[model samples]
Target: MLTEDFIGRVVIVLVVTVLTTFGAIHLFVTFQQETSASSLAVVTRTGTIAFMVLQLVMTVWRLPPKGTARGIESRVTSVAGTFLILVAAFLIPAVDSETVQVTALCLIFVGTVSSFFCLYWLGRSFSIMATARKLVTSGPYSIVRHPLYVCEAIFVSGVIISHFSALMVALGVLQFLLQYRRAKNEEAILRQTFPEYHAYERTTPMLIPSLSSLDWR
Candidate 1:
């Protein structure tokens, strides 16, 4: 007898695994074609590939949710916030500015590296939807309650910059709003599961890191 939760986990793992494999193949083909690519391009591709692999592993082994946001709104916002940039990328035409491309690459690299650390700290607590597995209040979470979202925003900003257009700008704004809503949904679940989360929330910034919180030592 297979429960819905087990089936859902299996599906999620399979989907992510497939996507990561395909993305790696695409990157490999691109690298082969552009043998003279810059060092940043090479480093970004490597980091991106590593991130995908780590995500796939984490998806397979993540802890079961202690609480999940109920209602269609939570589900819709989570899914939309996660994939909006990919949708925009597929629809928009990328710009041809060398300088902007370089900047975008730098941003993507930083976002990828930052996200990897966030995910590392998150460990088995990671999920695409608003669910509470464990309260992670250390590391990057100490700086911002939703460090993952901040890193994602950085990544998405780079993607939008590469595909700079009026429509993409609009979509980027929408994406940020959706991510905010998604974070709130996650916070609701976390607070419900852990009473101490309220204290953490009071002390920590939501998306933006507070300058005053830094020790600077």
Candidate 2:
């Protein structure tokens, strides 16, 4: 017997699946016709679509039971984080920055590709709200507590460089700040739930990965 709450979650999840799939197809089709598109545009569009695909997978299969949220801050910051992850790339002006180079394009691709590993490691632990699921301590998490956010910083920076816009610039900055706050709110919950979180926090920098602390192997 499916409860109303469970049915609601399923319905919302299905809706998200439809939206992300449609969004990915739309972006790809739009970009496919751009035979004259620059390398930066090509990479940015591809990166955005790849990100959407990964997010769809996470939401559909890999998510854990969402824990109790802290407060309004948790939900608000979660929305902000989602906006950055899903919508910000599309918000970037389709026009090329005219300043992009092959090197920059390469960096963008690298950031986009590298982020998948962290997402894979995160697995079912991913959540939009400040809720505890599993405390991932290996892979990129060993370096920075919020590896996904760090990766997004790199990936989004690359996208912004490829397609510059004043409004996107402001949104990017705001997203970065909100990501930090969102991560903090999550850490707060983790600290309360798990005893080991204090030591983890002490050793792991919140967002920026310290070279000295990172395991090189």
Candidate 3:
């Protein structure tokens, strides 16, 4: 016998799953609707859908209660980030997908795959806003304090470059700033919750990993 709250959670999860699946299907179908498709288009679109499915999977697993908000910063960042991502994706012209498209595809492929690495290690710990779930300090996390954000940056750089929109570039810049603040807010929570986070922070680079940041132990 499940409680109402538990049932509600299940409903929410179902709804999210449906939404993600529908969105992926919609995008894939749209790709086919195009007059012609290039390998680059196929690869990037497939990668985007793969990323979305992964997100849905992770969302279901991490359906547990999240921590209370630290402030409005994370909330704003979360909304803005989501909006920017969708806008960038749809704003991509349907045709004339040449120019830096190949390079963009490569960047997106790398970023999408790297994001999977970060998410796999993070497991059910993934969260959009700055809330302490479980601290992931191994795998990609060991490389950078915010490996997911790094991956996202790689992914979005491709979108902006391939499109080469002044507006998209501006959106990317804003997203990066929001993500930086979001990372800091998450860190504050983690540091307060887990004393060992300081040691982790000292060893790990905030965004990029290098010899100095590697915890080779």
Candidate 4:
């Protein structure tokens, strides 16, 4: 008989796989229709699609948690932090400025590429919730303990900038708080599971990279 964890993993993987497939198809169709799209737009859309696919693949193959957060609060915060900013992006009307659009695209592209590398470093250790699979402390992780969140802030900043509304700003602030909380929750789990996590925490900055401790390897 399949355990609850196995069933949950299957459901999560299936949901992500379906969402990725549809999202990729929609992006492809939009690209095809926009015959005169800018080069930046092309690159951004392609990178976004690639990121989605890669994320789906990673979710399907991600490691089982060594320990998970005990309560519903951690799960809710994790989900909201991961997805609420996206709601603002889709709901708010973007500014009608070519310069702003270009800047937004550049930020999005850079964030996407950087996030791809972070995900690569994370590999199977990635989790949507506050679960400790493995402690990764290399690559971008060496720069900051929560490099993925930093990349996400970059991406979401672009979105919020493009849609410069009061509501978007509010949502962005809320998302940031949720992400911070989620990071803390993850740290708690990691600290509980791994003895070395305390040393790593002491050495690494939470979100921002320290210029002194920049380690690429």
- Predicted structure 4: lDDT: 0.76
Deviation from native of the Cα of residue 187 in model 3, angstroms: 0.7
Q: Rank the candidates by lDDT, best first.
A: 4, 1, 3, 2
4 Cα displacement, candidate 3 (Å): 14
Cand. 4 TM to true fold: 0.83
TM-score per candidate: 0.82, 0.80, 0.80, 0.83
Candidate 3 residues lying further than 4 Å off, grouped into runs, are: 1-39, 63-66, 215-217
In model 2, state the lDDT of residue 50: 70
- What C-alpha lDDT, on a 0 to 100 scale, does residue 91 get in candidate 2? 49
Compose the digit string of candidate 1's lDDT tens values, residues 1-217: 9854566577766755665566565555545543333333444445545555665677778898888888889988987887666555544645556666678777877888789889989999998778889999888888888888889788878777766899999999999999999998999999999999989889888877788544321
- Ten residues in sequence with the least summed lDDT for candidate 4: 33-42
Instruction: Return the TM-score for candidate 2, rounded to 2 decimals.
Output: 0.80
Alpha-carbon lDDT of model 2 = 0.68
Among residues 3 or more apart in sequence or in different chains, the pairs in candidate 3 whose N, CA or C atoms overlap within 3 Å are: none
Per-residue error for 69 in candidate 4, Å, reads: 0.6
Best by lDDT: 4
**Cα distance off (Å), candidate 1, residue 152:** 1.0
Query: Could you tell me how far off, in angstroms, the CA of residue 128 lies in candidate 4 after the best superposition?
Result: 0.6
Candidate 4 local lDDT, 63-114, one digit each (tens) = 9889988888998898788767654453455555557768878787778878
Model 1 misplaced stretches (Cα beyond 4 Å): 17-53, 215-217
